[model samples]
Target chain A: MAHRALRIIAAALVGGVLSACTTEPATTGTTGKGSSDGKLVLGFAQVGAESGWRTANTKSVREAAEKAGITLKFSDAQQKQENQIKAIRTFIQQKVDVIAFSPVVESGWDTVLKEAKNAGIPVILTDRAVDSQDTSLYRTFLGSDFVKEGQEAGKWLVKEYEGTSEPVNVVELQGTTGSAPANDRKAGFADVIKGDPKFKVVASQTGDFTRAKGKEVMQAFLKSHEDIDVLYAHNDDMALGAIQAIEEAGKKPGVDIKVISVDGIKDAFVAMQEKKINVVVECNPLLGGQLMELAKKVVAGESVPRRVEVKEGVFTQDEAAAALPGRQY
Target chain B: MTPPDDTGVGGRPARAPGARQLTEHRLFWPAAVLAALLLGNVALTHDFLAVRVQNGHLYGSLIDILQFGAPLILVSLGMTLVIATRGIDLSVGSTVAIAGALACEHIATAKDPGSLPTVMSAIALAVGVAAAIGLLNGFLVARLGVQPIVATLVLMVAGRGVAQLITDGQIISVSSSAYKMIGGGYWLTLPFAVLLAAALVAVTSLVTRRTALGMLIESVGGNPVASRLVGIRAAGLLVMVYVVSAVCAAVAGLMISSNVSSADGNNAGLWIELDAILAVVIGGTALTGGRFSLGGTVLGALIIQTLSTTIYTLGVPPETTLVFKALVVIVVCLVQSPAFRARLSRRRRATAPDRAPAAGDVGARQQEVHP
Candidate 1:
């Protein structure tokens, strides 16, 4: 009994990361066993079901994989880096033909990527990327361009004010402080808006990317600055919150404030259709179909671009009615 | 000068003051800090304290503070009692999320979401689920002998997941005028949320103070073994407190979700538990348990609310807002602390004897020499 316990402890220590599946890829498609079935097996680790967009993205990936007749091994990391790392190591042990994941954060993946590289499993990044200096660790990073989304919002705002040379006093409702999306969106919007001398952001504050804080902060902005002509929110949730505050303050949101927001959620389209929100820039969450295509190409040893930006669009009030019924998120 | 009898765990240790001066009052620091923060806002924006009527309702910065802070006030009110019982309810935030998610999910799925019956049923379902969760928490701590923090932490983490499951991982938006009336409507020129919170706070104060329930709760908190020896049902008291805390959190959740006309399972009531705990601590309630003051907790909640409003009113850049709020909160806490005040008074006595009060502020320090 003592000898058995000792052996088990030794085995646990030896198994540093993954507990390798003993059955070995369900008796087919191990790639090393000469690919008996010729079916490509993909391992995917997701960044938990945190929001509408993330849920949509996960669904897209799952459905696309199913439609493409590929076997998928999916794991949810629950927005933790360690969990993602563990899942990746497990995938490596499982000897998946291709491994893909959305990194919870941008750093601390060098060790795992190196291990995957050693195992010769080509990795693909979906939805988000890692800040590794060694680019060879992953075949491609497929995601939305947040900065471009911000610019789209700003561009719409400029076009709205094109007929008049009147000074535009803008109030910004930012997302959570220090978040990548918040920083990128703010930078992108500022770059576009600064081109016009008549435009100035009069009041700016972090709404922490919630409806409650968005409304509360917007109320203060309306109170402090009575001449606010525009409201640019980093996301749709905040924009919706600010719309309530604007209405409470007896001002029409889309007309009086010319509200422009990012993230084309279903509610945003509803708000746009109701003429409460002027424009919405899409941060596409439907990356599943694209991901499956990329996964197949990488596993087939095709050389893809280092970066692939997801296709998104900018929507106006007129386009809202047509878009709302079919909106996924 | 010396402390009065029964200066329990984490007590002030000094009761020499006869309440002759305004500063001697327990509520003086919080009230003063609230005034100072509002004054700062007023200085920055000339109409910071202004209140006026618009569309047959009171509209102003003051009103907005009460309106926005109503949910926090309700949560903190319940937290005060839980702390009074030598217990903490970290699950209140999760409870908030769950309640909101339940209600929003119900309303969103209903055929006539705008109908009064639909809204009423939605509220009932939400509250019922919250109460059931409270019962579970109470059972865990009272019957199962699990530690309060550990017990509630389970819910705090899993409750959000449960909430996400209820909403199906979506930000469910509902349009119901009847549902909105709970949080967004005006009642007699006041926010319905504020009135509801006020009424609940008042009822809690009366129930705890009017009857012998308050003393029983405090006794159980002060010394559980002694309370048990004295024939007090500590388990019952424990269960009662957790349930009450959860009920308050549920109402707060309703107000928040109703106000926004939507419920976000992931973000609703996120981190509100920390704010509620802070409010209780700032209100001079000791976490080690014993005595509590509902009025003080209300003031603490108001101070926190006012501080946030003042931050926005001042437009103290987006990045520095959190840091600035933290510094102000630290100062408020330092001023409220009796130990800090005693140390400050001792330093002042060493430097300048003429500034000493005849009533003796040094009484708190005198207890330190016995150690």
Candidate 2:
């Protein structure tokens, strides 16, 4: 039994080494062939198609890469940090001109970023930022300010109920617990809403950023608190869910209980057009055209800003109607 | 069966023998525990048991518990049968995602998504495909001799990918009112999902108890080698149980998707298999397999749903919600354990010297019989 175990271990070791050898040359060969054609080769690792927003982001990146004539080698991480790291390593092995990715989470990218830096490849962060203290690891970061998004949502609600003496009891449907967007959005909204004594958040719970859970939690919220006047959902999906619950409860969503959500997805626009959702602060996923521009500048050895903030807009019912014609997500 | 033991201690009035026998029933403790939890909620939350007719339909916490618990009851019912055959279906959650995705995808791409024919075809495709996946799992475990855990684990991982591929990794939204009624509509002043679950439970009970199927499953679970020797067709029974479990999960998936009018492949029915397993265990269906109770499982599912509703009603902090749920579950499981109750009763009798020896003798006989 001991001898058999040893033999199995030996076979596994040999197989691992053989697989490594085969993968190494394949990446290098692609790099050599691409570079000989004198085209800017870029490696973009996406956070997978977990949501409609992510699918739109991936589509934008692919389309922009084609339009800009950049040889973009794309990898979908499928929402796993380890998968993102593996894709980054593959990018480094291929000696891509530049690397860009929207991270799944905020931390644990120090080692992989360092590896890319050592390979003399410039890294650009897109759509989401990392929490690494060493800013020198990446060339620049570009994404929506989630905190600002939440503050905008709060600002809209405050304006809508500006002179109301009746206290506006707001119930917040938070995103996934402890997620960066969830925490920042909650903080920013609370900070802005604290200025008004008439505005008070009655109940808050994490809906885990899914429509089903959002609906279920909203139903419970409706049962527990009968005085809720406003619903501040961290995302449009949750707002949509809350709309269903409100309708089922025989109350008008946008009129009886106003909804303000973030993420300017197409469904959110449609919901606003239907007057179910009151307001939506855009967390734009169309960063592909801008990301390609940055990649080209970096490859050409040109200096760029360390932070590029994407311009976002808030859409009310009227704005939603106008933008519904051209909404991409 | 003894006369003296039937007498109530501590100067309490002696209870009737029939009442004592009812309390000693296997399902009595679990049912009592569920009732106690509901009573606690009533004491805390005003209107906990209030039922009002809204738009000609029932609306209340009790109704919500039954409506929400319907899917779980279905999943655990299937799980009870599978566990009775000494197997588990860990892939039920994945099957749920796949079924929802298939149904939603079919409806979304259909020429007329709202038509009855379209909805019927969508349901058929989803349930049929889910059953095929279950058959694959059964083949791996029963025919190829794979461990049950490993066999189901294959689909548990791969089935999600298949679902994602089918939906193209997007939440497929549909607007089929006919399909929506299955989950979110009201029929005869009750939620349709609740009525569907009740009908399925009744059919399952009749089929299992009225025939020899339930006994054969128990025999196979008790001793597979002996069952096979006795011509029980254990492999076929195992396959049938798995297929049934998958079909139940499919129905649950349809309900979930219909409720939201969208199919989120990644999040729909996520981690539901674990909840179903917990329900089965809480219902006094041993994980080791043998005797099972469908009624007890239904009560177990309701208990879980009520606990969830209670958490939100009580306003427990979101961060500690899971911990609070685990604490309650631990207490319920401990209270349901016969061995634990027996030990506690023995210790109490030891404190009373007059009844110590007599109770000790009964305890010894119980241990002998159980062992």
Residue-by-residue lDDT tens digits, candidate 2, B151-235: 7877787688788889887888889999998888889999999999999999998899889998788888777888889888988
lDDT of 1 by residue, B199-248 (tens): 99999989998899988888887778888998998888888888888999
Q: Residue B236's C-alpha lDDT in candidate 2? A: 92
Looking at model 2 chain B, which ten-residue stretch has the lowest summed lDDT? B1-10
Q: List native contact recovery per candidate, as a fraction of 1.
A: 0.59, 0.41
* Best-fitting candidate, scored by DockQ: 1
Q: Model 1 misses residue A244 by how many Å? A: 0.8
Model 1 iRMS (Å) reads 7.5
Per-residue alpha-carbon lDDT of model 1 for A1-329, expressed as tens digits?
66566545544533421332121222222243322467777888888889988998888887887888777777887777787888888888877788889999999999999999999999999878788999888899999888888888888888888978888999999899888889989999999989998999998899988888899999988888888999999999999999999999988888888899998989889899999999999998898888888988998888899899998898998999999998987
lDDT of 2 by residue, A96-211 (tens): 89999999888999999999999999999998899999999999998888899989998998899888788889999999878888998999999899998999888898888988
Q: Indicate the residue-level lDDT of A204 in model 2.
A: 90
Per-prediction TM-score, please?
A: 0.92, 0.91
Enumerate residue pairs that collide in model 1. Answer: none
Q: Report RMSD for candidate 1.
A: 5.5
